[model samples]
Target: MVRRPTERPGRNDEPDLPPNLFVIGLLHDLKEGGYSRHAWAAFWRASWIRSIQILEMSAELRASWLRFSVTGIVLIALSTVAVTAYFGIGQGIPFALTSVLWWGILMFDLAMHLGLMVNLESGELQQTLGWPNRLTELRGLAAVWVAWGAHWASAGVYVPLVLVFGLAAFTDLLDGWLARRRHASTRWGRLYDPFMDGLFFSVAAISLAVVGILPQWLAALVTLRYAFPIFGGITFLLIRRRTLRVRHTPWGRASSAGIALTVFAAALAAALGLPFQALAPFFYAAVGITALGAFVTILIRGIEQI
Candidate 1:
């Protein structure tokens, strides 16, 4: 018996198929894959692509800055060694080590600013703008290293270094305000801004600890603000397979401001030859309260998401 035309196998009687059957089949396979497998693949792909792009972009962007960086580093190193030997040989080096350290920091900051500008302009021109996570990561690492160097300088010349630290802190505030006011804010700025702030505070706390200007407990408390949140963020991303959305929460901003002020106060007290121990209790208390507030805010937000 002849089948009806409409009912013939592989004819219009069959379910409609995609014109690009191969592409459709591949997409279907992707969706059917386990979530973890798909997630890992996506993560690795994103990370690999980002690394390649950042390396290429950074090479172009930092060419001039790298020259400056090398020159500055060499000069600073030579100055440091010379000053050390002179001091050992009973010839006062006329300049504080802290000054050299600050100079190095300023140079590093200039390099970073240059890199950031190049990256932002390139992104705009290419219409490839998005959050620059790799650049942000690099900036964060740089901040931490700078802070470490600053702390060493502070320990060597505590009073003069405090001034440099204060100025650097102020620049952090100014840069953000300028970016916002000029309407030049970008995804890269948002990530870099906070990472720098955290690094600055963390480094300052380390400096204070080294000089016995702050109680160990106080320094630890301040460090925990950044450390705990960082850990939490990593955990969330691993479990949820997504980065936490950046938000400008009032409490978060307040916490950061409070931390900065506390560090500034501690530095001032040290510089003034005041008994910094008395302020330790207050510092610890402020850190605890701000940290608690920040934690509660994060917890509430996490719950809301659920």
Candidate 2:
């Protein structure tokens, strides 16, 4: 089943953020000195210089632009790797990278779109985002790429795969804990945090399924479990041109946690030389909770909209 893309946010209720120092300074100068012919003529030159200086020194400006630049660079690097592998390296690149590339660009747009909101408010933006939180999203993206690696990973390499996947899963929890500890939760976090969860877990499930590490039936459920909300989110953004901002719910968190645990269990069962049937009990329970959670979340959002 095709699942909708997950994502969202709105800002009407939010108070306007203040302009950065450059703008504030210009405004202050004009208000204090009033407009004179020479000063007015010189103002543009001074403003341009001051703006450049401020942008160079401003942490927020650097951070926002830096994120966009870095993502663009990654895309280029992926493309280069793909081309090199196909041509120079005599190793064919996986076509899956195309999907990964587009997904990444979409995420890049989302990051910039959200980052711009708090850009002018350096203090607040810094408070709302940190290296740890950003790393979580990057980890999610890594999981997506890693999922493709599952195609090549099998019985012999399953151990390393499990350990790598475990790290990605750990980051999911780490980001939120870091945010809460710092009191840095923001609209971007609320919207994109779960979005990353869906992406990471879904891709991993699909890859594992392809490699026979997971049952096709279980993979389908897991995929749709993430797809529904994600596609719903993407649809919302396309039509409304804004984020959905669904309230974080208990069941939703449980669903994500359940998926992470269940996948780990599946990997572990393989690692331990246990039968797939042995994990049936755990998988069934996790699926039940996950499906139930998705239904409830969809229902709640429906009620909210009405």
Candidate 3:
């Protein structure tokens, strides 16, 4: 048989290509819309249009995010200073300074995670951080101050602790409701809310334990109840390269409520000069039961996600 010249793709005056080669070349041409130069021109033009549109839109999105973030930072700084100063004065200068330092560290940590404010559905930056998120931050700040002040609370100064703890508990209830009512929920709110809750209660548990309000074992259990889900979510993200959607299980909420109530009850008792130590067993049983329930339920739910 005589040998035939092999046709090159995108060439004229050549023999037709074999079926597979022809299909490949056709697909390549389709990538640019068609084989004609006009098609190629149109393809490049459309690509440029899309590129410009994306650049313009992204710049606006970034600007919007920056505005809200800056405003939020300012608000957080002002609130931290005011609250810490008010609560820390009763403790001491050192306590106030330490509280400020802790707040700074926490705000810095929050800034690191604040980039999650994008809408998961559209993958776009949210224009507004929303009042719900602002309220959540306020709640976290109050809880943090209370946790730190729990040490200085040895001076029979449980008033501020009770008030701050109450504020935290109230905001925890209100933030989600505000988010739903305003229809301003975002991926950031979903993730940040739980994280703040965990941070608040974990530190509160440890602080309460340090001050002899909660037993060591119960405190550890309370801390672990929030800690495990956060650890699991991070693990899932690292292993799967996707954000784990946090599911707010009833058990989880019940655990949080139990922990908060226990903290409040202890603080209130201390303020009233009552013997909370006598109720240690009751606190232990309640927190322990709820924590165990939340741990198992959340773990199973997280595993199901995986």
For residue 23, model 2's alpha carbon misses the true position, in angstroms, by 23
For each candidate, what is the lDDT? 0.54, 0.61, 0.66
Residues 240-301, model 1: lDDT tens digits: 54445444456776777777777777777666777766766776677778778987887786
**Residues 1-306 of candidate 2: C-alpha lDDT, one tens digit per residue:** 112366223321222223235434554564455656665566577766654554555576466656755664565477447546644443224434554565567555544444433422234444234644575557656565556457436635565468767888888888777665555555455566677777788788878888887778777887787778778765654344344545556677787788788788777777777886766777768777767877777867744644
Model 1 residue 289 distance off true place after TM-score fit, in angstroms: 1.8
Query: In model 1, where do residues sit more than 4 Å from their true spots?
Result: 1-46, 54-156, 277-280
lDDT tens readout by residue for model 3, 1-306: 112377334311212111223223434554556347876676456545544454355555445445655664565566556656766545455554555565566555544444445544355556555677777776666665776558657766776678878888888888877765655566667777888898888777788788987677777887788888888876665454455546466787888888889988987887898898888678767888888898888778677767
**Per-model TM-score versus the true fold:** 0.60, 0.64, 0.68
The candidate with the higher lDDT, 1 or 2, is: 2
lDDT score at residue 101, model 3, on the 0-100 scale: 61
Best candidate (score: TM-score):
3
Clash pairs, candidate 2, are 4-230, 4-231, 5-230, 5-231, 6-230, 6-231, 8-243, 8-244, 9-243
lDDT of 1: 0.54
Q: With candidate 2 superimposed using the best TM-score fit, by how many Å does residue 204's alpha carbon deviate from the native?
A: 0.6
